[model samples]
Target: MELEGDLFSLTNLRNMEIIDINTGAKLGFIKDLKINCEEHKIISIILPSQTFKISLFGKNEDIEIPWDNVKKIGVDVILVDGKNLVEE
Candidate 1:
């Protein structure tokens, strides 16, 4: 469920950057989303996988930021506390 009076458009969300507060890293942009249709809640935000030479041999996996990890949503960035839970 959406927080009371808290609403955001997917297009705007996609336009904002995701920044990690702990490491001050620009993890990446929001690539996609995982949502819970039955519950009407967002599960997580997806980010493109980190670049690696290993991808030449295997498929790259994208990163996910749980909804609970999101700390703030600003005009240009989404502040997150993913920390070590997310790699730079």
Candidate 2:
């Protein structure tokens, strides 16, 4: 399915898994997605539970994975560049 349609169809996207391309490791579930309403482009992905301490400290670091880093969108997961996650 197309990316936009796949994303919108998901009801509870916050719990959907996201994968790291290089290591094939599950990064985390998506907490939220940043989208540009005017351009209708995805800006970043927010993984709220990746770091427990950060979440506790009231700093939910949303890993801003640019649209270019997205490898694919599956039925229940989003694939992204592992290098980008590591670099952050």
TM-score of each: 0.80, 0.69
- The TM-score of candidate 1 is 0.80
At residue 62, give the lDDT of candidate 2.
60
| Per-residue accuracy of model 2 over 18-60 as CA lDDT, tens digit each | 8888898888877667799999777777665456555466775
| Model 1 regions lying over 4 Å from their true place | 1-5, 53-58, 84-88
Clashes per model (N, Cα, C within 3 A): 0, 0
The true-structure Cα RMSD of candidate 1 reads 3.5
Worst lDDT 10-window in candidate 1: 1-10
Worst 10 residues of 2 by lDDT: 1-10
Give the Å shift of residue 33 in candidate 2: 1.3
Residues 1-88 of candidate 1 have per-residue lDDT tens digits of: 2232267899989998988889888988999989999999998998887665345557567788888898888877898887646532
